[model samples]
Target: MTKPRPPLSKELQLRVFRRDKWVCRWCNRPVIFAPVMRLIESKVRNAGRVEPLSYYHTHWTRDGAPLLDELGAVIDHIEAHSTGGSSEEPNLATACCRCNVRKSAASMHEWAKRPQRKPIKGKYGEPQHWDGLSALFVVLAKRDRSGLTASEKDWLRVLAGATADAR
Candidate 1:
């Protein structure tokens, strides 16, 4: 019998998110934290603020409908694993919940060829702000890793230097 594939390590998952800047490779939409809804729910419980902050509250549409929260980044195999793709970084990308679910097990080429929905626009045709908690989520989700690949370590060092320079 074929051995069951091991689950991806948490570190690897975070790395993929960082590498992709928490944007879906397919749709380029920012993936927001799913847990923020829980945070809002907790506030509702403690502060008793009921009207605006419902348990089902999420990013709202122009039409006043609630857009479902994306929760967190999902690692998608650019080449489906069922088609012999390995779990290495090269084969993986960060995907928003919607795109990932829609893509399913389709090959990347097939997915790319499909028609894409137009991105939502704001008043005056400005792009809607989709990165609600991206910076905060990135900071909270990443962990320092001792066993990072050489490139990963180098990228972190560069980021550290940039941060230091800003101060």
Candidate 2:
């Protein structure tokens, strides 16, 4: 037979949820299906009565976004307690279904280092120009890689050519 776990105390859950402000700690935003419960006694202005706390694990999306439900939303810890992170309010956050899964087991600092934050060019964002010896090496390595696809090779060639012309 499966073991059943004891329910958490209402006061304790409320304390943790309130400290998190119903947002995911890592992303600092509400995820879609993060587990949230309605506090029958509490209400928010315009947002309605009740608040979200946590949700079922199944609701975590493949890309780490939270799924939304009629009841409310879910909150997640950026760094799970199992990984030596705290269970305090500062450790919790509200995330959409996706962000939570993506942030799994990662501290905010580690998650922020993910390459997902790539720079864009033009109006989308500013391009980060390569600088220093390491940057030059990346340019050269990209150019010299015979295994690179045509598009990648073309981009590397362009970068190398531009740098060479500048020098």
Candidate whose TM-score is highest: 1
Question: What lDDT score belongs to each candidate, Candidate 1 first?
Answer: 0.58, 0.41
Candidate 2 C-alpha lDDT tens digits along 60-161: 333222234321334456566546665556765544344545666666678788854222234654323312122343444443365444543443444345
**lDDT of model 1, residue 167:** 22
In candidate 1, what are the lDDT values of residues 88-146, reduced to their tens digit?
A: 99999988767777777778788788875444333564324544354432342234234
Model 1 poorest ten-residue lDDT run: 60-69
The 10 consecutive residues of candidate 2 with the worst lDDT sum are 33-42
Per-candidate TM vs. native?
0.57, 0.36
